[model samples]
Target: MNYTLDFGPVVAGLPDLLRGCAGTLFLAVVGMAIALVIGVVGVVLRESPVRPLRWAVIAFVELIRNTPFLVQIYFVFFALPLIGIRLAPTPTAIIALGLNGGAYAIEIIRGGVQSIHKGQVEAGFALGLHKRDVFRFVVLRPALRAVYPSLTGQFVMLTLTTSIASAIAAYELTSVAKLIENESFRSFEVYGTITVLYFLMSWLMMRAFGLVSRRYFSYPVR
Candidate 1:
């Protein structure tokens, strides 16, 4: 016995898959933006003098980092509604992705912040810069430069994890593949094509990250 492959259905569903790809990219972009904000705020709070705030950030980071992301999304999609905090599927998926990525980002950014020399911060303040300015220029910028590679890698993982958003009927790449497989019963072809598309997307994302690093993080040569 032998198996034969058919790609006719996959070819026909290219448009749906493309739309799904767009949705996936949208989620990743918005989710990463939210994650960056959360990470920055969390790191700042972790260093804050306020004991409750520091403990809150610690609890958030530990909870999300320790739990399964799928369960997190389910909670966002299903549980939140019961408490009068309803959200559409797309927003729910984005929030879930952001929170999940943000937890790991907090740790990554904290490591970068800690790696900065204390003298640089002191020097910034001695230059008449305000505390906020000092944190922004001397600490945050350099810290980001130090940890950007790791941060981008984490973003890549988040992008791939968008596939799980399909569980909530979020119209993304994996959802499209599932629909195509259901309609055409061409599991091998549909998934095979999606695998290629995902690879290309990941490669493009890495290239974009490279450009961002070169433009923003490059150190001046003497």
Candidate 2:
């Protein structure tokens, strides 16, 4: 009951923390972009007629989904160097986040694709659309629209997961906060401030996503 609160350190470190927020957003945005690519490509392969290809995608999803992300990052950072694939901490973190998010994204996107009626796909073909056009216009776009909420939710989670990258010395909010806490011994203040900052970042991301949904995914008005 004798502890005194101090926020001087937190206030002094505000600039660094703000930069860290930018780092966190950079990781999240780049990671989500990679995840989207993987999700779309994986879903295509998952639904392919080639049993081996489908099984390969299935195995990848299961492997990533079943494993711990910490271990995955460790493997990438440690094991890859053994094979002459050395990467810096930031790049390693980005790749790990993308793979983790992509695994879940594959399942989410697949559910959306499954919800599309088979007749719709046929109708696209009937309209003389090329195979690629049919898949893109009739299938992918609607599937994405149907699942945009889930996908964005996963991205938000992925943004939070960026904190885990701190374990590997990746330059994000939590990592910066850790340095501040170590230097200032202000665990409560440092972590408390970062917590609020994280909440704001997540809120901003949701708002941006809402604007995108309205502009791109909303159905045409009658």
Candidate 3:
């Protein structure tokens, strides 16, 4: 068996790839912001004096994290119409990814929060600071800082997961690759190009996150 791979169509579709990348980045940013907010809310609820609220948040996180993201996305895109609710592809994609990512972030953030020493909070209370101020000035900053690397790693993973958006015709990078493959009949070459692009994009994200950690975290080098 012999196969000839043509790279021309993939090269010609560079503009489409750029557009998809922009959309992918936009979705990732929006989704990560949503995920962060959800994580914080979940953490606060988990720590609430109200026991029932904490358990409810825990159950929500467990349900989302244990389920498949594809099913979640399909439900968001398809099930809503039956209830007379509509969401544009972008929001649906963002919400699905955000909710899924947020579930995982809850655990990650909880671990960071748990790692904090009691002295930090005790000291804040010792100074007569309010509960909100103690968490804001002490717990929040340290916890987020401790988990910064994991957060960025999760964001990169979500960026890759954005490829699933193509399934619902969201026109992401994989969708562009599909178009090129259909036109040129070169699945190997087209998909190979996609692999390289994904690698480059993820590598860039890793570097950027590393830089951010260096600037914001500044842990002892020793």
Candidate 4:
């Protein structure tokens, strides 16, 4: 009952924390971009005619989805150096985040792609669209529209996962918070403030996604 809260350290570290927020956003955005690319490409290859290519994508998805992300980040940061593939902490964190997010993205987007009706693809072809055009316009667009909410929700989770990158000394909010807490011994205040910041960041991300959904995925008005 004698404990009192002090926010002096948290207030002093606000500038650094704001910078860390930027770093977190940077990592999340880049990682999500990479994951989206991987999801799309993996889905294509997952449905490829070549059995080996399909198997490879399946193995990747299962391996990542089944493993711990901490281990994955450790492998990327520590093990890769053994193969002469060293990367800086930031790059390592980005790669780890991308791969982790991408595995789940592959499954999420595959579900979306599968939700498209075969008849719509056939109609696109009947309209003289090329195979690629049919897939892009008739299949991919509508499928993405259908799954946009799920995909964005996954991306938000991926954003939160950036906290794990701190284990590797990546320059993000959690890493910065750790430093502040170590120096100030104000774990409660530091963590509590950063917790609010994280919630706000997630809320902001959802709002941004809402704007995108309204703009790009909304059904056409009559």
- Return the TM-score for each candidate structure: 0.98, 0.99, 0.95, 0.99
RMSD of 4: 0.6
Give me candidate 1's TM-score against the actual structure.
Answer: 0.98
Q: What value does the lDDT take at residue 89 in candidate 4?
A: 92
TM-score of candidate 3 on Cα atoms, chains taken together: 0.95
lDDT of 3: 0.88
Candidate 2 — worst ten consecutive residues by lDDT sum? 1-10
- lDDT of model 3 at residue 190? 83
lDDT head-to-head 2 vs 4, winner = 2
Model 4: per-residue lDDT, tens digit, 54-140?
999999999999999999999999998999999999999999989998989889889999999888888889999999998889988
* Per-model root-mean-square deviation over C-alphas: 0.7, 0.7, 1.5, 0.6
lDDT of 2: 0.97
Which candidate would rank higher by TM-score, 2 or 3?
2
Pick the lDDT winner. Answer: 2
lDDT of 1 by residue, 1-222 (tens): 787998999999999999999999999999999999999999999999999999999999999988999999999999998999999989999999999999999999999999999999989988999999999999999999999999999999999999999999997999999999999999989999999999999999999999999999998789
**How would you encode candidate 3's per-residue C-alpha lDDT over 1-222 as one tens digit per residue?**
988777888889888888888888888888989999998888989989999999999998988978888889999999998999888888899999999889888888888999889998999999999999998878988999999989889989999999998878776788888888888898888898889888988999899889988887877778
Error of 3 at 1 (Å): 1.6
Select the stronger candidate by TM-score from 1 and 3.
1
